[model samples]
Target: MDLKAGWDGTWQEFLQVDKTVFINELISFHSSLDWTLELEPAQRFAWETEYDLMKSMLGHVVRESNTNPETCWVAFEQELIGEGGKRAADVNLVLPTGDLFVVEFKHKTEASEHEILRANSDLQTMLRYHSESIGLVGHGYLVLTKPGAKEFKHSGVVCEIADKGQAPLLTNQLITSLRQTGSYDVLRWSKGEFYRQPSILHGTAQVFFDTKIPTLKTSASENIEEARDALLKLYQHAKAKLKRYVVVVHGRPGAGKTLLGISTVASVARNDSVKQSEPIFLSGNAPLVQVLQHTLDFYGKRKGKDVLGRAIDGRVMIEDLHIFKKHIKSSFGSRKETFVVFDEAQRAWDKASPRDSQSPSELMLFCNWLSSQSFGVLVLLVGDGQAIHRNEMQLEQMLADLDNSVRAQNGNIVAIMPSLHAKNMRLIKPIKRDVFNLKTPIRQSYTEHLDKWIEAVLSNNSALARDVALSIESDYPLRVTQSKSLAERYSVELQNTLHEGNRKPDAFRSGWLMSSHGGQFIEEVQKDKFKPGKRIGPWYVEPPSSDNSCCRFDAACTEFSCQGLELSLALFNWGSDLLFRDGQLVLAEDNRHRRQYDHYTEGSYRVLLSRGRSGLVIKCDDSETFEYLKNCGMRVV
Candidate 1:
């Protein structure tokens, strides 16, 4: 029987689908059981009172796989002992050879924490009793079959489940009759565009369109969807032309450029309409790269597909831009993915050699090479004023190198950039600009003018900054404090409040951001996140309960370590490196990077000031610096 709807195959095909493919097993289980009732008069009254039909159905289904089927035919035989009282699951499927699946049918729309714990306990008890009899050690699923909205099971935090390879914690494991409380998780998953149902009068329906795999989301926003469409169309144009295209999808920090990039790739990968090969997602930001790869890989595991185990052919490949550069160089004549996503592209290092063969210049040259053999479209994800490193290349440098590389080979080069960059370059037209740019303010709620205020302050125009700050200060509060402890407490309050809004609180994060200068003096304590050889992967991904969580606010990240990351609330410890001096933004005299160019210092602060999504609380240790910032349109704590 074909019971799959239009989107059933699509769900199975997605790299991140859930592991709930047991409906057919259920159908087969039903058929294997016999409905023969040879009940005595006393047994008939008890069984027929409520579940006359269920008596035979349940007995047959449970004993079908048993060699001694009579042993599995017992009813109301086992009980789950809980702290509150005794409880039992509605239906428990205990097979010596099959999985230890407990189907707990809850008629309610929601599963409370206690109920979830109860169901888990019952499953463990039943599994222990059944598995010991069968002599198999394994993990199992607690399938709640309710069309419910509340789900504590999907929270990734199961309260009372024993680990795999360990004996299950049980109360009583004697065989029992089954009952039903259902949350149709399997049904909800397959109900994509159409319904797949088995009618009593008719058979199953089969013809329907495939499910639409949605764009990847950091947060739900329509602007991002539109941006993804525009991006997809841009690649469509480039693919049609079969030309080397260098397109910069630029936005303000947290404006969803990264989301757009990945969503575009997912769209193309699923459809194959806009791509020649599986697109390669690359990033120079190590922490962001780690986060994306780890997340996708972990999600893929649930579907039993190593989406990135090979990261070649039909699989998704996310690599560090530097590492990918090595692949391009080493495999000179080998076929490559025509579509490439380079995140934080402006931070691409300058040429190491005299020939400039190691930099992003090489990437452009590679594109030039691809123009001959196969077309290439290098989509660069950039942010406004995000270049902080001295060695990093800017939009102008990339364009010049792209033009030079194309001219050297006399190949056609198509360049597209946001209109915001047009002020710095003449080639960017307003017509082409809108398609490749994302301008929605997403860092904080009602903080539409926040970027303008940050830009004005960094530009040293106090009056303009003050006026702009007034517009967003009520919504996206930016506070200054001389006490570091006060800043920490305030940020924690922000973190706690934001986390409370989420059912799975681990998904939201808040952290402290400090500058690299003078970070060494603090690292000696050994709790230092800025210490050499420390990785921010755990700091970024771990839950708040762990010491490694950034929300703990114990180990602070420097600007370089956290350029592409965001926080629900940001607690910044303003180091002496960047501060106001003589009414101008300047690096301190004793600053290690004081000799560096001026814009780099400003860019570093711009990245820092914008990290907080909800709001920002800055710890200005210096009295003069605190006062200067407070007067410059910052709210005082």
Candidate 2:
């Protein structure tokens, strides 16, 4: 088997590390019976020793077994990257019959509930890897190695074989016998669920995902070239000065601010820096980081670069703001990083924000930290709109009274927009003296006018929204509806359209943007009931797909879940969280599910409305809201 092709690129280098000596050591350790097995029954073995013991057992099986040639592979401490996090199986054994058995060893007499759950999660990951690499599914085993441990059963039974004479030899025989008979079926306990799915980039996201080696955008239009040139100029200016620089890149949802920031950092990495500091792209959104990291890693593998090692070496770091903050704290009185591209800077909180009650706000601390840097530092604060949460400190609040001591310390703050007088209009006039605008809407599938329409609709300016909508050119269809059933039908139609009749296992993703608040209401109205056992997760992971008696329905993907990602089509279940009346938007006061603040209500809807590049079908349950939209001459079905 070509292990290199089956393994993720990050693990390619690791697979080459010599293991022959380790295997020989394992054989020696097991054959001599010089282990610490005679220790007190209550005394647990060390984690490393337990792990090594399992590996030795697997190596022993491979050394002794006379099984088929194909399944004669064994790997110790095999690391697997899952959507949730990194999972490593203590030992992995492959059988000649294209069967994989992943075993998790516990040194303790009784495994804790958390340990068992972790093992189950590891099992899920192994099954997915097996399916991908060998074209077959696999099972996992939980082995307790404490002396005199009793076997226990849950979804899968726990095996106890500690202190028995030649225990490793016996366990190997048992596993080999099971593999030959095809009797081991531990995966049945977990029902074989895989979290990560194939992702397709669309609109602004696609544009960003496609920019130059690092960027993949096929089009190198004037706007992108201009932005790249301007960004390079700013970097040169920052490098020449001893003073700190703070630049703000503000644009509409699809203005490519995020892309500009990422590309600038990647561009900087191509050249050596005098300050000996690498640029790091930071965001508060976890999903955004995951998507970008995965994309970069995929490209890095093709180029034979260890992307994970590069991230570790700080060549180009894409990390969450929290981790960045931790790095800041860890690097005291010294700055290891000189340049930072902070995405969604507006989301940072104020000192009075509830999330900052115990500590200074992130913005305040970040600014303070940068001011104290020994050398020049450049901060690209990229963001748009107001606070989504009540306690969030909006960009306006953070930039208040910009002409202060910080600015005097060789600090420069500039606003980058599409034009001096842009339609989205979130720029600060007094603070933003230096302005640069990106005229093109890279994320908009059709005319940039659609973004203006979205802004008007979100701002509750019904008149302007209607006018803009009339003049808009859409590449995809848009339908506003009151009937939930019709909306669902349109949703399936859009899903089929996104697939383009490609019968491949995973061609594209399509789902409904349901409000998190009305779980009961959604269940009652939708054709398929949400899965009985599955709970909704954050934006990074797709929710479990539910199957009704007649058809399968993708779980309601939420605003937070779909924030940094794009969809081929979005079926928005316009909930009561935001209502329309008298040509104005109103927040439903009595709505139990209203979690986001009033300031964020508009921005939230705007994000959801713009998620799909191909199509958008709005399902509004409220009669007044439906009529209001209809009166505005919306394409209501």
For each candidate, what is the lDDT? 0.51, 0.51
Residues 399-486 of candidate 2 have per-residue lDDT tens digits of: 5422232433344433333333323343343233233454445543353666666777767677876776655422345678987677
lDDT of 1: 0.51
Tell how far residue 32 is off in model 1, in angstroms.
Answer: 34
The true-versus-predicted C-alpha distance at residue 105 of model 2, in Å, is 62
Alpha-carbon runs more than 4 Å astray in model 1: 1-227, 230-244, 273-276, 298-316, 349-360, 412-433, 444-448, 459-464, 498-503, 518-534, 581-584, 591-595
In candidate 1, how many Å is residue 439 off?
3.7
lDDT of 1 by residue, 203-239 (tens): 1000001123222222324566676676677667766
RMSD of each: 17.5, 19.5
Backbone clashes (count) for model 1: 10
